[model samples]
Target: MKTLNTRLDNAIKKLYTAFHNNTLHPECCKQCAVGNILDNSDSWKHFSDEHGSTKLNYVGRVNEAFGKRFNGYTPSELLQIEVTFLKACGYQLPIHYKNTKPDTPTDKDVLFNGLQAVIEFLCKLDNNLNVMDYTKIFDKIKCDFIEKSPVK
Candidate 1:
């Protein structure tokens, strides 16, 4: 049986390859929670210049953001797994904000908070050494994970 880590690794590679090959739509990525955070944050360029990929930087950022570690999982490995899991569960990028209101937080802020919540939940599960499928967990929490605003 393939280990969860192995599955995640393969998934990450596949997505990254698709993206680089132009098979994955750039807009799709921009909408994804992970992609949105990486693209908008300073970490994108910093990590890209250092690791050659923003995806790897995300893993490290999770560690810094949460102050926790997953056993037997490097930052890169964890990020690949998380991204793969998120994509498999059909999470799309957040709606872009117009930033019309300077005082109020933008859509990106809300989305980033939501993504952080999801990551924190995942990390807690990982820290507990739970090996269940990520999709199941996401299904249980997705409604709350991604907040929605009423359409005008």
Candidate 2:
């Protein structure tokens, strides 16, 4: 069994490459968050007819019933991650062309936002801390331990 940390690391690396290569796209099954996590496979699209729908389709339901986990994420988790990514990137749910989207879908900022959201969700899935969260670094406090030369 692959650990969730390993899966999360691999997903983050794949997403980083896709984002830097300008290949990540909300409309592209093979370049979206779930696709990248699944090694750029579009098979995840079979989970649902709508891009951001959390409701699993027949295929997805069967997969879930079989305890299918792609890259350590369940069928429903995949949908939620994609929806979170799309929403963070400023796209409306279901990803209709008529729906709202970032002014430039390929913009670094937009993709970064999407990636960040996905990473956070992935961490949440495993009950792990968000690796991208730097706030904890700032929370670190230095404590000085005093040595006692003698005890009375």
Candidate 3:
């Protein structure tokens, strides 16, 4: 049987890649059913072929939008609830903040505990994890972390 920790790790991987690596475009081969369920039309942004800078629209979280509908929302006005939620949950934008900026875990802490906190926090939501699994990955990270600990 698969452990919860592994499951959580998988969940973190899913969300991380979804945010940082998933490609977006209008003409997709993947089947999308969320638009029908949410009853809102999708707006696909056009690409600038010169640089491939297609500012495609992300399909933001539906649950968050539905929650807002009761608090006064219209399909015409889109609330960036997913990004808002991640910001609230301490998920840093641009990712560099986690490594170099204030209001975040220092490199030492990340080497020891920060990544676990990230996984646990994200797992509390739609993620497929809880917290303990981070402990396991920590073992794998510790060797490199200690080896590369900045001596300053």
If scored against the real structure, what TM-score would every candidate get? 0.23, 0.85, 0.24
Candidate 2: misplaced stretches above 4 Å?
Answer: 1-4, 141-152
- Kindly report which residue stretches of model 3 are placed more than 4 angstroms away from their true locations once superposed: 1-7, 11-106, 126-129, 133-152
Tens-place lDDT per residue, model 2, 83-125, is: 9999999998888879888888878888999999998888888
Give me the displacement of residue 56 in model 3, in angstroms.
9.6
What's model 1's TM-score? 0.23
lDDT of each: 0.39, 0.85, 0.32
* Tens digits of lDDT, candidate 3, 1-152: 13355534454453344333332111121211111112223331111111112122233234334543312222222222222222333444423323322243222332224234444454563345564465668887997898999988
lDDT per residue, candidate 1, 1-152, as tens digits? Answer: 12355433333344344444434322244333334334322332222223223254554675646655333344554445334434333334221243122232223443334344444444454453323346767876877656664556
Candidate 1 Cα misplacement greater than 4 A, ranges: 1-54, 58-69, 93-152
The lDDT, on a scale of 0 to 1, for candidate 1 is 0.39
Pick by TM-score: 1 or 3, better one:
3
